[model samples]
Target: MPSILGGDIDPSSWSIIQVDLSQLNIQFLILCGVAGIDLAVEVMPDWSELPYDLLVLVSRCFNLIEDFLNFGIACKSWHSVATKHNFNSELPRIPWLMLAEEEEGNSFRKIFSLSNGMILNKRIPKASRKRCMESMGWLFTVGEDDGETSLLHPFSGVQIELPHQYTTVDYYDH
Candidate 1:
């Protein structure tokens, strides 16, 4: 009783909905929901105390499931759930190339992957939300005048110079 009262709030009592929640990382969601402190008071019904309410928990599970999907798409942790079938289907059959971004209104830029029409690179982690929409949404490319294009992450404001002039660990890291 003391453990339940003083320990972290836990929603593990609820089970996965058993639906096609492949888009939602159920395991990761459970971990997130368990982080807050325990409830201040436990409600009672029919003059009986319930350790946990199953109905509310089920609802919370559904909500968390939605969050999990968004979380996966926004981050790199469970991105597999988003592109799990890319290589196994028609997504990998046709290939496209990344072209250079042209004039103000021109759209001739970046290679689109054959798989899912992406840049042949996985989605950028949500941590780098401002890094580049084109990072994953569009394929990066080198064109005739594509000299050392700066990879400026709008979020961190970190600019990684493309077409590096020097070979170092930082260049290889990205």
Candidate 2:
């Protein structure tokens, strides 16, 4: 009986049921009935096949910036659609503020978006034991001993090192 189903079903299970779908028509009918009654068994559509314009429209309709960001990050296809659209202008006017707290030799930074009331925790690598300054979406980290300055984007994870002798205060002043 399992050989008839092309080895997809176990012979032991066939013995338990005492019946096998002996015909293709009977199998088709059973499958159609099961599909109609079972929503969980429904096939998922390919998100990559969705139109770019439609995805952008849906992404821009999100109320929260975090949700919008997450929608874009859901897949590479979705991200490509998001990057091509000017959805950032549609986001709420949120001022992102960086708040830092130091505890037990570790520094924790929280970025709060005033418009959406979303607080995001930002991780700064290699700057945990250093003096850090946050302003205008940029983190300026200064090494305690070497006094080296590095410009970091906490959320985007992009870091650039300045000249070894560069002063953060002087750089910011200019």
Candidate 3:
């Protein structure tokens, strides 16, 4: 006799039973109708309907570049909320080295983040080609041709114009 999963349910152990498909469907429908009646059914919240304050608070909790970036890209509402505020607060992110490869005097920059160990090679033709300073998780850069200073957030690709340089500061040496 053939056994199923070491069980004694062989051909002789059980009798063949037939089921009516339509009758079973009807019974299932009736059960559903009875259970779904007059219970003030609860529905899951939509993505946009999530609380704004809660999202901002949760966004501030993440410190890693990858983790924070992933949180912002999760949904449209999340992205909007994250960009509108300083989600990381005063918490310092992992320092990343932005080293420009000197190729024909116009080179691409390699950003290596210490937080998640992500190496990004980017070409910024629109902005500065050389790094000026790296302090407190921000990169200050000066354009080669225009000498315009700009601040960049390495992981997020966010750049902002810096005020005019008042004094000359040596970037290479102390």
Candidate 4:
């Protein structure tokens, strides 16, 4: 009979064996001795400490923004790579559908993705207590009672105040 590592061995002496990678210390040494393999044990790598360029390369493989955001939360180094705005995936980003506000004074809003049927709860305090409309990737908001108007970039948390609804001239009234 032929041994698994090569050369001939007695079939009567052979037996089934199972090795676990996680508990590969003493058992691994014993296996190497049996197989005539002279090798040293090596330590596993810490994934969080991977090289910066390698992490960036891995980050670029994620086409979904949700997956990319989750990857950033894995470790500080990964977060740095994710926040660098360097994603260059060939695939386009999936558009998210912003659901209506749940209740008054709620800081979170539910966003749905059509591609994967995913729902993400995003914290958007600026849209609270306002009537919001999506236009050109910006949230056009108007205050319910104060009649205040503004344009908000939901993801970046940027808010630009516009003139009050009553202050703007009615072009249709000409």
lDDT for every model? 0.39, 0.70, 0.68, 0.85
Query: Tens digit of lDDT per residue, candidate 1, span 61-132?
Result: 322223435534643433433332322332222434444333333422344655454553322232121222
Best-to-worst order by lDDT is 4, 2, 3, 1
Which structure among the candidates has the greatest lDDT? 4
Which residue window of length 10 is worst by lDDT in model 2?
A: 84-93
lDDT of 3 by residue, 1-174 (tens): 557568666563354322456668788889879888554578877866579888778888887747778878878988877763545767765667776555645546777777677888776543345546776766788766667788876556688888755445764364
Residue range 15-84, candidate 4, lDDT tens digits: 3232344356777788989999967678898999999999989999888877888999988998999964
User: Which pairs clash in model 1?
Assistant: 97-111, 98-110, 98-111, 99-109, 99-110, 113-118
What tens-digit string does per-residue lDDT give for candidate 2 at 146-170?
7788888776778888777554457
Model 3 spans > 4 angstroms off: 1-49, 126-131, 136-174
Clashing pairs in 2: none
State the RMSD for candidate 1: 24.0
Which ten residues in a row are the worst by lDDT in model 1?
Answer: 122-131
Better of 1 and 4 by lDDT: 4
Clashes of each: 6, 0, 0, 0
Winner of 2 and 4 under lDDT = 4
